[model samples]
Target: MNKSAYIKLVNGSAQTEITLAEVKKLFEHYQHMTSLTGQQLGWDYKAAAFPYTMEEKEQGGIPYLLLNGNQTQLYHYLIVGVSQEEETGLHYIQIVLPEQATHGDLAKANEFCKYLAKRLKGELHLFNGRIIYYNPRK
Candidate 1:
């Protein structure tokens, strides 16, 4: 079966649903940008794929991506960070997926986060999941 998920872009007290395809395309852009940076700084051009986790905060606006990966649960991580909303200041955004995800799945997730970050002109981190990003500043 084709995997499906719901993603929300957190931007300053506002959230919106974004399509998975858009997220994947965004990842492609991020990869290209990272590749350029790697060449300029003599760094590796490969990105790592890591596992992650997502959960709703007891009292929260959006969800949180917490890093919880280990030897036994090698595929556990969080995709949490601040993003801009409506051209305003930064806001928190969180994305979660099921455990034991595939590389393709992680790629899509990374793509989505990278896409949103670029759109908001903000920085992002893997938190717990393994990612070989060549710096988001580029």
Candidate 2:
């Protein structure tokens, strides 16, 4: 069984800010795409309660969420984070699975990652370090 999976999107040479507006749209689109309601998901932060809706939270920061369990069950959430290359400081958006994630969970995460990678016009890198999606020059 695979322990985890990842979808990483690189932002090229420039480091661009991931705006709240973009995240909000992504969340909305995700909800629409998956037909997932508030009860089905939650932010990773403890102060944030379950049955939480994205509309209820203020936008403007990188946010992570759990699919069906609380924080202690790390394997159930969607992680959104930024990684910077040491030499150039170029940023990449990463969506990764928790340590105990199952194949079904990974499938869900990958679906969302595919949508985000297309929307962001970034590369989709799998946990195995393969570039799965990228725009080719015309």
Estimated TM-score per prediction? 0.34, 0.56
Query: How far out, in Å, is residue 80 in model 1?
Result: 13
Error of model 1, residue 70, in angstroms: 16
Model 2 score (lDDT): 0.51
lDDT of each: 0.44, 0.51
Report the C-alpha lDDT of model 1 over 84-125, residue by residue, as the tens digit. Answer: 356644343445555555455556566666666556443455
In model 2, the Cα lDDT at residue 130 comes to: 68
lDDT tens digits, residues 43-138, model 2?
Answer: 332223221243322237544443453433333554555555577654466655666665555665666666766676666676656666554434
Q: Please tell me which predicted candidate would have the highest TM-score against the true structure.
A: 2
Name the lDDT of candidate 1: 0.44
Error of 2 at 116 (Å): 0.7
> Which window of 10 residues has the lowest lDDT sum in candidate 2?
43-52
